[model samples]
Target: MDPIEAAIEEIKSLPHDQSFTFSEIARKHGVVRSTLIRRYKAITEPRTVKAVKQHALTPDQEIELVAWINRQNEKRLPPLRRLVQNWASEIAGKPIGESWVGGFLDRHQDELIAKWTKGMDRDRHQADSWHKYKRYFDFWHAKMEQYSIEPRHMYNMDEKGLMLGITNRSQRVFTRRMWEKGELRSVLRDGSREWGDYPCHYL
Candidate 1:
């Protein structure tokens, strides 16, 4: 079953008392709690869910999320509730909820996500003589060979690329707590990863 669909059905099967909190569902999936939030609602509606699966992270909040997640390291990742709270606080330029921190963490499975994360630096430029003058690179390469010097001068000759993926859509909590099958996908996106549709075959 689809992750989101299965999540919803699971939530519906649960008792209403427990259904009101997404943390419970997140734990079941072993994902962090933020996995459940979407837009102004913690639970993503089908409409928003469709957009996300399509890889459209253009929503204002989502865009902001990508920027923040990309710049930080996975090690800086705090507890789910704290992560969400910090996300809001950082984006809104003010403190929000402390409880949200924990709620968010419960949504994602830490183990599976151990290698998944946000942010990257891709704008660093290298003054490559290769592009300016084909002969420039050859000259450097040849020069280094003559002196037996390490080709550190032209070691790196290309610019880096940055790709940010959607971690959470971010939703508002209507009731006291959050409840939803917290399913977060640790997606990686960059120019190379960009495509009009999902690849036909999964790697």
Candidate 2:
């Protein structure tokens, strides 16, 4: 049975006593007192009330779009925002822009997640395939025992870019002296003056 219908029936089943108020019944049945009263009245009046506003896409059509997105995810190739917008426009029989897409996503936030994928160079991504990494790790682990190699010897290197300050030229920072000593404060060097190499060791 529908939950609302079931709740209405449960409310009716309560003892006909003044102690069992509408608030108590509604709370026990997991519904608002106003909603329970409305449903109760609708039961006797036999008239329907329009509850929700019209949506751009019907619930079934939205579910179909969500299914398509899940299918794309299963294939490990999610569609781009533009592709989704075009698809929605095709289904909607109108030009759907970013604003419409955003609203649609907001409406169906429970079934979808917005993600920003990091940009990767095509050549680098191709060389970093899962199968290649698996093979390399398998070989490395197999030779570990023969070479008496410990986990500390294994390491990975990553390179990243850093942005310097707004101006390229160095600037002096003014500060109050403790005792007016002739010696000035230590120079604050810019850490982004050159490329940095980070070593990640595995243990």
Cα lDDT, all candidates: 0.42, 0.53
Worst 10 residues of 2 by lDDT: 171-180
lDDT of 2 by residue, 97-191 (tens): 76666776776666565544333334334545567778977988877876778888764321222222222323221111311232222212223
TM-score of 2: 0.35
Q: Specify the highest-TM-score model's number.
A: 2
How far residue 129's Cα lies from its native spot in candidate 1, in Å, is 50
| Candidate 1: residue 139 lDDT (0-100) | 72
How well does candidate 2 match the true structure, expressed as C-alpha RMSD? 18.0
Candidate 2 segments whose C-alpha is farther than 4 A from its true place: 1-54, 122-203
Worst 10 residues of 1 by lDDT: 172-181
**Model 1 error, position 26 (Å):** 33
